[model samples]
Target: MKGKYVEAKERLRGSIAPLVTPFKRNYEIDLDKQRELIEFQITNGTHGISVTGTSGEPSSLTVDERITVMENAVKTIDGRVPFVPGTGSVNQAETLHLTKVAQEMGADAAMVIVPYYNKPNQQALYNHFKTVADSVDLPIIVYNIPGRTGVNLEVNTLARLVEDCPNIIGVKESNKDFEHVNRVLLYCGRDFLLYSGIELLCYPMLAIGGAGSISATANVEPKKVAEMHNAWESGNLEKAQNLHFELMKLNDVLFKDTNPAPVKAALGMMGKIEPVLRPPMGLPSKEVLKEIHQTLIEYGKDVQNTFDM
Candidate 1:
């Protein structure tokens, strides 16, 4: 198990795109488009693929929908790159079941978010994560997005979880608190695979020993996002920095509204998906949409001619 984990750790680092779950106009899971999206990521040089994550809108999906997405993601990925599915749900039983399903489907790792809405205390959080980790042999990457989750996984809590669960290997820090993340690496040790979930922090995180980003921007700019990491890894710091600066506008614009809305709109403009989001999470307004479209043009996405497609 240790040897297997060592191999996973090595392969799991890079631009792991947390894919937007493409939906049909009727809001059904478009499995065909899902497969296409995976293929697009692979062909465009995304280092890894994750499904049913924040960008994939797992909260909006039924348990069966999430599992179906994972199953398809596993088959479509087909060992080309590491597959990390967001298996954590607000419900403990559901988190366990989805994580176990991910394990059964041969996922390289499972990304479980800190439980949201209920806002459990740190001890409860630790207990929840430890239970999931113990239940599966799959490596776990804890997702910490306090903005969305309504609770912070304190540095001590993360440290404790790491000490207790050998399979809990990393964290995707969507936090904006720069000092907090620094302390995480400081206390948790540099070997911890810290990934930046915040778009603007992707390059900065790499500078601070982050594994890579599970960035939403990668949904639109897979090649460049992957190149940023590849450049950094290959000792081309200047190229990496340049790409970071170049990607800044698109990164900022995508989050101007909510997540996958802007992302789906951008992809739709590029003729990737239908830009359909499930109800209650609708498309961005015309103003935000215009800004997104303009930004994509500035970033050379060739979306000008494809918006209506």
Candidate 2:
């Protein structure tokens, strides 16, 4: 491996928090809050930082908005940690453009998700990823979230992309199917970097040789999340496993509604961010909010006293 790719592979592991694109109540992009969130993640010991991924609501943001988030993240992170920005969209041109922007801005890696909504076939999937990978010099982490994309990235297809594009170094498996994730490392080789995107599988994936996670749960509990990875890597399996089971409820509640909504609400109750989500992605229901509030209290987060009943 080249020196740069080798360094990225080493540094990009662990709890890479897929950040929420914080918005004001009026639905404006809150860059200032975004920076604050970045600082929060860093201070709390997050291993790396990723923005504009599933948790960040990429579909809702304009191309320019995505670019702006990448620029902001690059500036704020400032070499403190590895930065991997979500640079994929359903449109090929947009994906290429955003990825190029990320590389130009000096991101450590670019996570290109499977083109959603189109439901492209394996060959098409291979082609789409290879083209994007070929377009940039940065390491590319193929994001396979079949649930949202309506198309699964077969292991063979991913293997082919890895073979074809040298820069395509790893995959972020947001998939729930453990078998599929197993096959990816099996076929792609144990050296292939697999980062878990599923909150529940974060530790298990590590046990199975995954590099780390880009978990949404990290948005609420960066310290513990990063600690889970840190513990496992440090050979403290018992501690890591305990944290894994400990985080299960938080993981469950955060996803009780669509992502970012529940996570945003949790952050809001904690007074970290405003807890506002964009249109078509509102705050969690009163019922879910109450559950989240109670969950936070149990988890020892200082949830605000003003939580509505």
Candidate 3:
């Protein structure tokens, strides 16, 4: 039962990109531009990329776009990097459909968030994840972000799912709870991978044996995030800590508003893509964008200092 879990954990143990969806001026999917972003992340050293996550503005995308992106991601990467697609929906039926689509699209795994809006109870949450895990042949990474989802994936529920749903391998622990994260790791022992979903908590999560990050920041600065993961692998504790702290401020800036807005703005500042987030997610406010530009450059300044060392 734990064999697949172990393999999936290893598959995710690196700087996985929570990829940003590039849109045209009129706000349509730009497949060619998205391909370029994939090439950029891969060439610069990102280990994996996950589509339809919060950073990808999941809610902003239509189901058709989600399918298209999933297909495009696998086809664009063409096996150069690992792929994980988000398969969470308020209903289990939709979740199953997406998970099956992800498997069909050749994703290595699917990141399933707890049911949002409806706020399911503990048992309901367990069933939702277990049903998906059992339905799909691909591995699953539980995405626990109470902040966005309005519910939590409690430790007990997680432990039970891992025990029962063999393919439910690990979690993108988003609450920044090292204590809870460590407990899950210890409970499942070697069977579970603890993926840091919060960019600011990457180092601390790694300190407690977290495998790596499903990081939003990695979309903008793939090289730096990869280097920090490499430093951790090499046992260079000080370097990893300094790099983590250095990026924390920028992380706050990006999340200050609804996700992907500030990050898309920063990427625009870096000239990676347009700052256009779809209507409901509209552009970050002028003042927020100004602060984002300043904070991110500060992160860049720190990166330069580290390189100059």
Q: Candidates' TM-scores?
A: 0.97, 0.98, 0.93
Candidate order by TM-score, decreasing, is: 2, 1, 3
Clashing pairs in 1: none
Q: lDDT for each of the candidates?
A: 0.92, 0.92, 0.82
Angstrom error at residue 164, model 3: 0.6
* Number of residue pairs clashing in candidate 2, backbone atoms closer than 3 angstroms, sequence gap of 3 or more or interchain: 0
**Candidate 1 residues 109-228, lDDT tens each?**
999999999999999999999999999999999999999989999999999988888888899999999998998898887888899999889999999899999999999999999999
Q: In terms of TM-score, how similar is model 2 to the real structure? A: 0.98
Candidate 2 Cα errors over 4 Å, as ranges: 305-307
Which portions of model 1 show Cα errors greater than 4 Å?
Answer: 304-309
Tens digit per residue, CA lDDT, model 2, 1-309: 577887777778899999999988788899999999999999999999999999999999999999998999999999999999999999999999999999999999999999999999999999899889888889999999999999999999998888788788899998999999999999998988999999999999999999999999999999999999999999999999999999999999999998889999999999988877788888878999999999999999998744566
Candidate 3 stretches greater than 4 Å from native? 2-5, 299-309
